[model samples]
Target: MRIDCPHCGLRSNEEFTIKGEVPKARPDAEAGQDAYVDYVYIDKNTRGRNVEHWHHSGGCRAWLVVERNTITHEIYSVIDVQEAQ
Candidate 1:
């Protein structure tokens, strides 16, 4: 698979580091047990559209935010992390 890094253009998947799903929330150390566990260990693993973080380590070394389909692997959008946040 190829991921198009905005800074580096089209490149093989090997050029980027997949940083898993985008975090929706983080629990405080003092939060409830279940909440903390859910935040740290659980993955809702949504079946459709999902956002991911990717780093172009082999190319421009820029962080990218990617909107992709979980089941189809179709990338709908790619943006720099700077712009995403």
Candidate 2:
């Protein structure tokens, strides 16, 4: 698979690091221990399209948010972490 890093242009997936899915919002302090445990330990393991955190470690070394398919591995878009915010 290839990822088109905004700063580094097209590159192999080996150049990047996959950090799993972007997490849901953190539970408030009062939300309880179970909520926090689920947030930290559980993997949603979404099967279709999802947003993920990727680091262009071998290239520009920038953090990026990648929108892609989990099953098909089709990358729809890549954006810098700063720009994603």
Candidate 3:
């Protein structure tokens, strides 16, 4: 697998670290058990396209939002989260 890093360009997936899915929003602690469960386990495991959090461990050490195709394990885009917004 390969991912194109905004700073470091395209590189082997081994150079990056999977940091799990990006949460849509922060959960409120007061929301209790249901909220905690959703926050911890509810994620769209879509096969085609998805946004995931990844760290370029072997490059710039920046967090990136990667657009990937899970089925083929191909990365389409990678942008630094800091600059994305």
List the candidates ranked by TM-score, beginning with the highest: 2, 1, 3
Which stretches in model 3 have alpha-carbon errors above 4 Å? 28-30
Cα lDDT tens digits for candidate 2, 15-85: 99999888889999999999999999998889989999999999989999999998999999999999987
Query: What TM-scores do the predictions have?
Result: 0.84, 0.95, 0.82
C-alpha RMSD for every candidate: 1.7, 0.8, 1.8
In model 1, residue pairs whose N, Cα or C atoms come closer than 3 Å (at least 3 residues apart or on different chains), thus clashing, are: none
> CA lDDT, every prediction?
0.87, 0.94, 0.84
TM-score of candidate 2 on Cα atoms, chains taken together: 0.95
lDDT, candidate 1, 1-85, per-residue tens: 7888888788898999988788768887788899987887787788999998888989899989998888988999999999987
Clashing pairs in 3: none
Comparing candidate 1 with candidate 2, which one achieves the higher TM-score?
2
How far out, in Å, is residue 8 in model 1?
0.8
Judged by lDDT against the true structure, how good is candidate 2? 0.94
Encode model 3's per-residue lDDT on 4-85: one tens digit a residue. 8888887898999998777768677788998888878888667688888999998889999988888888777788998767
